[model samples]
Target: KIPEPAVAVDAVSITPCGEGFPQCDFEDSAHPFCDWVQTSKDGGHWVLGHKNVSIHGMGPS
Candidate 1:
């Protein structure tokens, strides 16, 4: 199954993670709930596109 919802109707917006996106550094803001995080013998990280939502009381948090 696809892990996350593919589309959101009331999207707040899509923002680029910016110039050093996905590049690890000491100062990068931690994405504790990143959708594409994976773990195995060889660790991995991926940047999945995010659709911010502005609706209230719609889905479980």
Candidate 2:
């Protein structure tokens, strides 16, 4: 069984990207944006790459 969170989560605070906010281009940087975090609980995770992805038809064009 899943354990309940210790504190209430406020989902309404989330927002879309706006001016002055740094976009998630997944470029040069080694990590995700400050507001984001990396997790592999599902046995899969994000990989940072350049130009194109290794798996065909999977990532950016």
1-61 per-residue lDDT for model 2 (tens digits): 9988798767767677464344566554665442333336834443333444222222222
| The best candidate in terms of TM-score | 2
lDDT of 1 by residue, 4-57 (tens): 759768858878857424444335356544333333653343333335423232
Model 1, residue 32: what's the lDDT?
A: 48
Q: Give the TM-score of candidate 1.
A: 0.19
The residue ranges of model 1 lying beyond 4 angstroms of the native Cα positions read 1-8, 23-37, 41-61
List per-candidate RMSD values in Å: 13.4, 12.2
Which pairs clash in the backbone of model 2? Answer: none
Instruction: Report every candidate's CA lDDT.
Output: 0.42, 0.44
Q: What is the TM-score of each candidate against the true structure?
A: 0.19, 0.22
